[model samples]
Target: MSGLRERKKERTRQALSDIAVALFLEKGFDAVSVAEVAAAAEVSKPTLFRYFPAKEDLVLHRFADHEDEPARVVAAAREAGAVPLDALRDHVLAGLERRDPVTGLNDDPRVLAFLRLLYGTPALVARMHAYQGRSEELLADALGGADPLAARLAAAQVVAVLRVLAEENVRRITAGERVEEVLPGAVAATRRAFAGLGEGLSSFC
Candidate 1:
């Protein structure tokens, strides 16, 4: 089932990613070059290329699975006669309770540093914008292909609010606020953000 070539490739990819994150924290992401990452990971340039198509892949790969989360939440709720907004709101709140990183629940110093790295690096920000577009596309498709207008509008609003909430969480975290201290604000802010869609979400709540 598992070929030697594939297994070795996976190992090399992980090694490179591990080394890259460490270097990124130690020296800044923009300052680190592919060559340095390869050397630091004990991998050749071509080998690194085979593993990660580009330098951005190192950080982005971690976010790949999360790209589908919004869509998955919507789809799951639809089968139960729930609107997309209701579905997504429930998913967000549930994630908060679980202290999921995607919900910004674990915004400790290391996580805040990672957020700073993404914000400070121009290329990473550009890639992140691209990823946001993909997330919208996924949600739109999940919301029934009949009318894209509704899906697009809902996805845009939901994502905008979610991003703002996440940013605020990181802000509080960086300012030395604990998770418990920041949660009430986060919850209230989230409710306010979803207030316009009260009919659908209130029923779910």
Candidate 2:
């Protein structure tokens, strides 16, 4: 029953997010209101708030699944007796190979639309910084070393590198470059970014 309830709740949450995103895309993010989204999803405003505390969350929830991905990659690498930086590098390369939206290497129209929506919204952009901060903290914990400051600094650098790499990919794609045309450059940039990190953090964590 507990599991069933959680699944039902997840469905409701997804439904609300879907409705909210459709409405936002149709109109605009700032033009849409939380109350309107609640009405469209057929849920009470309070209930919608229960699932997403803020209006920005309706869109940002799309990223919730990957919020801890970096940390998970590090943890899994440690368990497999692999270098965390190498594992992270491979993980990102795999994402690019598969055109993952998180990697900003996907050219799917739906994904492009969503990225436009996310990047064009000031509120969403501001909220994303909070997400990045959390990712760095989780990665720092995963690094787990005697010098907490070093772990935190390393995590920050890693997170910033990944973020910048993804942003560059997005910039090229949004500026009319095809994903195929950008693939080689994106992969090379990712390698260079990780190589820079490896110089200092190869043995880290």
Candidate 3:
């Protein structure tokens, strides 16, 4: 049945992700090839590509949660007569309340090492930029018919702020700061980043 096959496919994908993470942890991501991952997961390279179009997706897919977030929040706010940017700000800051381990907030050595690898490698760094460009495109669509130029400029600025905040959190944690200690600055950055937007777009927020 389609349902049974779908479940099996999901299991295979999870297996690949798990094995890939383990391998990346053992041997740096840059050192591992798709062939090795395919061998480890007992699948062909084509099969792996069927699940993830790119090797970077194996790791950075975890970071693409916000691709549709802004659009969703904007829609919800409009439906509730809430302001767009303000709603977006609230939605974002609220999401940050969770110290997602994927955010490099935990004391796990593997996670820290992975973060180091991502920052150290030029290819991964370029991949991150490419992902950002894609995300901004999604945000542009979310902006709907708003002032086109303003919407795009606003979306780019928000994404940039978020990227900086995430990088800062990772750096602080790597420097031996606990998540709790890093929380204030992270929240403060959110507020600072949105304060102007919130005020400027008060009518829409």
lDDT of 2 at 180: 97
Clash pairs of candidate 2?
none
User: For model 2, what is the alpha-carbon lDDT of residue 114?
Assistant: 92
For model 3 the local lDDT of residue 83 reads 75
Q: Tell me the tens digit of each residue's lDDT in model 2 across 102-179.
A: 999988999998988988889998998888999999999999998899999999999999889988998899888999
- Identify the leading candidate in terms of lDDT: 2
Order of quality (lDDT): 2, 1, 3
Model 3 lDDT tens row, 1-205? 9999999987777778878877877898888999999999889999999998999878766565655666678778878887777887676566567665534455467677778777666777788888887766677667656577776776687667667767777889889887788887777887887896666644334
**TM-score winner, 1 or 3:** 3
Q: In model 1, where is the ten-residue run with the lowest total lDDT?
A: 196-205
Candidate 1 positional error at 29, Å: 0.7
The reply for model 2, stretches above 4 Å from the true place, is 203-205
lDDT at position 88, candidate 1 = 72
Local distance difference test, per candidate?
0.75, 0.92, 0.74
lDDT value, candidate 3, whole model:
0.74
Q: TM-score, each model?
A: 0.84, 0.98, 0.84
Displacement of residue 193 (Cα, Å) in model 2 is: 0.2
Clashes of 3: 4
RMSD (Cα, Å) for all candidates, in order, is 3.3, 0.9, 2.6
